[model samples]
Target: MPRTLAERTAAFPEPFSRVRGLRELSNGVVLLTDWIEEKVFAVDFGKGSATPIGRVGSGPREFRLPGRLVPLPGDSTLLNDVGNARLSVIGPDLAIHRSIPAQRPGAAYSMSPRGVDAAGRFYFEIPPWSQGPAAPKGDSVDIVRWNPRGNAIEGVGRVKGSDRPSWQREGKPRLTPGIPMVMFGSADGWAVLPEGRVLIVRSGDYRIDCLAGGASIGAGPPYAYPQLPVTDADKADAVATFLQDSPMSGRGPNGGLGHSPAASKEEVAAMVKTNEFATHHPYFRAGGVCRPRKASSGWSGRFSAARHRCSMCSTERAGWCAKCRCRWGGGWLGSGGALSTR
Candidate 1:
C-alpha cells in the first residue's frame, strides 16, 4: 500500500476552484494550475501556503484555462494555457517571460502540450481537424517543433499511432462526447525525453514508444488489455457502482421520492447495455492522483518519464516532471483522493 509523507490543512492565499494540473520540483516547490481561476499557484511545502504565479487574464502574463505546467531548466517553465491557445514561459520568480501563440491568429488548429527536447526545440501537436485544408495527406501526423530563439516552426516526429474516432470507423454518426469516440489503441499523450527522443503514450492499447526525428528508436514495456468482454455480472456491478457514486440517487429535484424513487433493475440493465464499455473504460488516464484531506491536506503526487515508467523517482505512484526526481504520492489535484499509477 502507498504511504503518506506529510499531511496538514493547507490554507492557500485563495481557494482553488479547479486544479487542472500540478508538478513538484526538485527544490520541493509545488506548482499547480487552476482551470477555474485560470492561473498557476506555486506553493512552498515548508510554508504551508500558496501564491498565485500570474494574474488571470488574456494578456501576455495572464492565462485562461491553464492545464499543464512543464518545468524547464533554471527554474523557468512552460504553461499550457489550452483555453487561450497559447504557451507562456514562466521565470523562476513565477513571472511570465514570454508568450508563444499556439496557432496562427484566428486559425482553428488545436495544439498539444508544448514539450522541449534536449536541444530545446518546442513541439506542438496539430490534430486532424485543426490541420485545416492543408492537413497532412495520411492518417499518421507529425508534431511541430518551434525554435524559440528564432521564428521558425518545423515538423519533426510523427504521432506514432492513429487516433481516428470509433464512430467514423463504425460508419456511424457521432452524437455523444468526442472523447469516448476516440479509439482505445490511439496515441493520447507524448513527452520529450531528456535525451531529445519523443516518448508517446497510447490509450487504445497500453504502450509507450520512444521516437527520434520521426522514427521509433525503441519502446517501453507492453501493457496488456483486459481480454475478457463485458459480462452480465460486470454490467450489474458497473450500474451498482454508478448509482452508489451518484449524489442524486434516491432523491428528486425537490429532495423527495418522485415518480421513480430508485432505479429499476431493467432500467439499470438498459443503461449498462448502452454505456457499459464507455463508462467502465474511460478515454485515458490523467496520470496523477489527489489524496483526501483526512489523509494528506496538501498536494502529494508522483512523476512519470514515459507513460508512467516510475523508475526515476522513489514514490510508489506515477506522475510526470521535467525537473524533479522525488517520489511523491497523491492524485491529480482535483481527484479528491489518491490516483492509481497503473
Candidate 2:
C-alpha cells in the first residue's frame, strides 16, 4: 500500500476577499495580490504577518486592481496593474521602483504580462476574438514575445482558445450577448519556463506541446482521463459559486473594466440557471498552468469538474514525466520546491 501525502493550510491574520496571484520573493517572503481589495501584500508566513505594500490610486506609488505578480531578476517583482493599464516594478525593499505602460507605443491593444524569461523577454497572448462587433475570426490565439531592450515584438507560437456557447438577440445583428454559464468549457493552458521554453496544454486532447526560440520542439503523450458526466448537483454548485463571485456584483471602486451595471443577485441567478449545460465535463480546465523555474519540470494542474479535484501532470524535456492528485484551487511552487495551494 502507498501512503498519501497530507495537505497543509496556511492561515493569515485576516482573510483575503480575492487572491489572484502569488510569488516567492528572494528574501523568503511571499507576495500576494488581492483583486477585490485592490491591494498588494507582502506576507511573511514564518512570522505570520502580511504587510500592505501601497495604497489604491493611479499615482506612481499607488495601483488599482493589482493582478498577477511575476518574479524578475534580483529581488524585484513585476506587478500587473490591470485597472491602471500599466506594469509596476517592486524592489527588494518592497517599494515601487518604476512603472511601464502595458501597451506599446502606437499599438492598438494592451496585454497583460503572462511570463518573463531569463533574458528579460516578456510573453503575452493575443486573443483570437474580442467582445462586440468583432467575434472570433479563428480558433487559435497567438503567443508573442517582447524584448523591451529593443522594443521588438514577434509571434512565437499559437494555441487553441476555449469554445464556449453564447447567444444573440433575434433582431440585433450587432449585439452579441454573453453566456451566463458554460458548464464544461475547454481552453488551452500555457506557461513559460525561465529558460525561454513555452509549454502549451491542449484541453481537447489532454496533450502538451513544447516550443523553444519560436520553433516547435516536440509534444508529450496525451494523458488518458475519463470524461465524467455532469450531474444535477454539479449544476447547482456551479451556479451558486458563480453568483457569489460574479464580477458584476463584486467589482470594487475600479468598476471592473467597463462591464454593465451590477445585476441583482436574483436576476443573475435566474439568468445563469437558464443556460444549457454539457452532459459531460471537458478534459481539463483553462488558466491552470503553473510557472516552472529553471532546471525544473513544468506542471499543469487541471481542475476536474466531475471529480471535484485537481489532476496534476508534469512535462520534462517535452515528455510526460508524472501525474498526481491534489485539491481543486490555484497553487504555486514554493521556495522549498513544495506545491502550496489555496
Candidate 3:
C-alpha cells in the first residue's frame, strides 16, 4: 500500500523565473531548466546553492530554451535543447559529453525525444500537428525508435493525436467557439520503461497497453473512473491559469509557436464568456506519465481535471495502483518512492 509521507522543502538561494524541467541525479544534484530564461542549472539542495551548467546561446556548450531532462544510464542525463534543435548529453562530471541532432539525416521532421533505453537508443515522436506542406495527415502519430550508434530510426508503435475542438467554416477549418482555449480533454499518454518497453495509457477506455519492438505484448484491465462534469468555475479557472502561466512572447494566437504577444485581458475575458468545456475529465493526464530510473513501477502525477492536487498513481506489469496524494511536480519518481518535481 502507498501512503503519504511528511513533506519537506529544499529551498534554493534564488527563485527560478520559470522552471520547465527538473531531475535528480545519482549524486543528489538536481538539474533544472528555466525555459523563459533559456538556461540550465545544477543545484545542490543540501548546500542551498546553484551553478549554471551551460551558457545561454546556440554554441556547442550552450543551449537556448532548454526543455525536458531525460535520465540516461551511467549517471548521465539528456537535455533537450529546443532552440538549438539538438539533444545534449550531460556527463557525470557535469560537462557536455556530446550532442545529437534533433532531426535525423534525410528526415523531414525533427525528433521529439520522450525516453531512452539502457542501450542508449532514443524513443521520440514526430509532431503530428506540424504545419505547412510537411505536416503528417492522420488521426494517429507514430512512436519512433532511434538508435544513436547506427543512426537508425524505426517506427515502434502508433498512438492517437491530440483531441481539440475544431470545425470547418467557410470551406476551411476553424476552432470551435465556447471551448475554453485549454481544457483537460481525453488524450493518449505513453512512456518508456527502464527495461525498454513502451506503456501507452489509453484515455478513451482508461486502459494500459504495453508494446515492445512494435508489437503488443500485454495489457492491464481498464480503470473504472467516474465522469465528473465540468462546471462554470472550471472554465473560469482554466482561462485564468492559462493566462497567468503563459509566456510573454513566442506564442501564436492559435496556441502554436510564433512571435506574438500574450493575450490581452479583454481577449481573455471574451474567451471565458464564450468558452465551452467537456463534461468530464480524462481518465489519465496527458504528458504526465513517467517511470523512475531503475524502478519496476511507472507513475503518473497530478489530476488537474479533477482538481486533485498532488495525486499520483502507479501502473505495473500486473495492474494500476492508486497511491496517496502528495505535494510534488510530475517529474521522475525516485527509487525510494520520493517524487521529484519541476
RMSD of 2: 6.7
lDDT of 2 at 207: 81
After superposing candidate 1 on the true structure, give the runs of residues whose Cα lies further than 4 Å from its correct spot.
Answer: 1-15, 105-107, 132-141, 160-180, 183-188, 202-207, 225-342
Off by over 4 Å in 2: 1-6, 130-137, 166-177, 180-183, 230-263, 273-278, 304-330, 336-342
| lDDT, each prediction | 0.53, 0.65, 0.66
Better of 2 and 3 by TM-score: 2
Tens digits of per-residue lDDT, candidate 1, 46-153, equal 787788788866777787657766646565777887656688888877788798886665657645454565567777676655666766654556677767677576
Clashing pairs for model 3 are 178-274, 178-275, 178-276, 179-276
Q: Return the top candidate by lDDT.
A: 3
Model 2, 1-342: lDDT tens per residue? 111223344545566766777877756688888876777999987899999998888888888778878878776789988777789998899999889999888676777777888888898886544333443344566788899999998887877765544442223333333453356566677888877889887777788788987888998887766666766655665565454443452344645452234456566556556665787766555555656433345565443332222213321211111133222333444553433333
Which order, best to worst by lDDT? 3, 2, 1
